[model samples]
Target: MQSIHFISGLPRSGSTLLAALLRQNPRFHAAMSSALAPLVSANLDIMSSGQEVSLLMEESQRPAMLRALFDTFCRTTTEREVFIDTNRSWCAKMPLIADLFPDARVIACVRDVPWVLDSLERLFRKNPYENTRLFGNDGERATVYSRMESLARHNRLVGYPWTALKEAFYGEQADRLLVVDYEILTKAPEKTLRLVYDFIGEPWYEGHDFDNVEYDAPRFDEALGIQGLHRVRPKVAFEPRRTILPPDLFKKYEHMDFWRDTAGSRANVLATKRATREDTTTA
Candidate 1:
């Protein structure tokens, strides 16, 4: 790929949909999360460990080695001019990416913390017959409260990327980050995509068909016992449904939306007006 960018942020946010839309541009190759980030971390750990062979790792070669990993992992996409790698860990690895791809931009797809929990809760409730891989033991999947708590732990699916996103948003490379609100994207996708194109400095792709968008990962979702986890509707209209969380639980995280309070904000946001505020409260 000639150019490399990143897509990352909260779970249940619009990263998957963004990828589905972006790949419409033949010059771009975008997809679900890849093993590249963890692979990079593992290699670095091995090289820096006290093992005798660790001495062979030259400091001068670290950048080349790390970069080659991307080159090799993305070798199949050579025909595509841009590769928008989607990995939540990329937000945590901003410093490394800064050193590797100076011109790269990271688009963070985000939603209010409570709404994020609510969406996950809806998925958990949708498959009551199958215990999800999202939580380990039966105890963790016992109720909406249990499931939400499990998913919000520091190392869990929702929290890790959320924490890493906050890190990138406040780090020295904050200028490289652009925060996209999920509500705004669903409310006004075309305008949102226009801003995204401008942020990544790509030519405006005016061929998007919002009503015909399609993306799904049945195998991936099925493996996790969540049939629609990565599913995107064929059309892109925002669905207005009451949330499924308990009232107290929903209110607990309502104020956790740090991205909304831009008192000293450095990241770009598209959340001036929330799209479906009237339907935000969960039933």
Candidate 2:
């Protein structure tokens, strides 16, 4: 069975960043978001079901739609073994997607809650354009943001809904799931990429040779008329954040010891160190 790899996470949690890095694999045609309309239309089951999807996508029949999608994805792209799609909202629907492609691989990106919340707030407050396609309207953004945080609340005791979902869907299953930290991937691109390549069963590129390869994400958004929302590609360098959350908010959000347990003390240490490093760098 072939694997359809997915990169899922909270919006602004660095899904695109990870996707761009993974796309460096010469054998993969990484799509920011896969188009399911044609595949869904070909399968009647998807058309009939009136399931409401996330703000970013319309829901379709799970089994049929996913099969058709994988089939079409395999057919259209020259790459035979694996193809990648990075969609943050897909994290919420991992169970269904896992059912769709039983053999698929997934990378669930994660960041600190305060950072995620702050990004959500900024995205809503400063959407440069009032474009429905990009920001999905202020009301919708607020609702979706609320829903995500609410979902996050469910595992409040452990603070590991996202990580737990990733694990349940992909982890400890032998050959399918790999969780990549946003901070590590961004800070130490080479080491992380090597690990990812190995996990996907692909050879490391020449000296991790992703240097000049272009991953213009806007190529996909442009066709959908939602170009204003994302960064256009050809990005070659990592720009670590130089800003830090206020001390009070940081303390409040950072108290989730569960994050350390699930992500490991290493990742937690890196996340905090990176945040502090950025503050110093900026100062």
Candidate 3:
């Protein structure tokens, strides 16, 4: 039986890094988050086509729609032993999708909460899709970012729905379900990759080259286009090392240790006061 690995976690939790590393292995076929684009678009299309999809429909049935939508993916990968899909937020709907994969492994990629929010804020201005999809209009984007309370609430709400599944799945079959911390993964890529390979029952081969494993490089610009295929853009080469929050705003979120350790820590806080100091020393 073919197996599916559901790579999930909060957004900006290093799911991309984990997914990229997994894709380096020849036996693994990493689908990235694009696996669900068709299903999401199809659902929207159906609703737009005047077919009423009940919000109360049982979760089991949702997977049926996805099964039909992802049939092409399943067909194309008949030769592969494992098919992977890395969508951190998809954990919220795992019950609906897990039905399609009886022989699947679920991997949760997590990061410190504060770090997650810090990373999210960087994308706030550029992320137009969330404004339209979650909120009614793009005008409210500024409002959402301006209010500290609303931003925190939004972040919590965004990730809360997936917590229960993470608890239960990891609690019951700890080995089958993996939780990889973003910090550890990035700091020690080869070690983490070995653990992931072992979990999937794949042999570790020495002299394997991982330095130039191509990920979502081609889809970067395509992601900028709102229309067309709607491919989820992967990480790019350059990104801002830290987000600069206002003093008042920093004070509000300072209690989050993960954020403090990386961005708001004593060293970081002090460094900000001293201009020309090395801000990139550690985070």
List CA RMSD, all candidates.
Answer: 2.4, 7.7, 8.8
TM-score of each: 0.94, 0.61, 0.60
- C-alpha lDDT (0 to 100) for residue 15 of candidate 2: 63
- Predicted structure 3: lDDT: 0.49
TM-score of 2: 0.61
| Residue 117 lDDT (model 1) | 87
Model 1: colliding residue pairs: none
Candidate 2, 60-145: lDDT as tens digits: 44465568666766667655456777654444454556567665666666665555645544443454453434333455345544
Q: In terms of lDDT, which candidate is stronger, 1 or 3?
A: 1
- Write model 3 residue lDDT over 59-118, tens digit each, in one string: 466657666656666557545666677664455544445456655666666554444555
Q: What is the C-alpha lDDT of each candidate?
A: 0.82, 0.51, 0.49
What TM value does model 3 have? 0.60
lDDT of 1 at 60: 79
- Candidate 3: Cα lDDT at 260: 20
Error of 2 at 72 (Å): 2.2
- Report the error of model 3 at residue 24, Å: 1.8
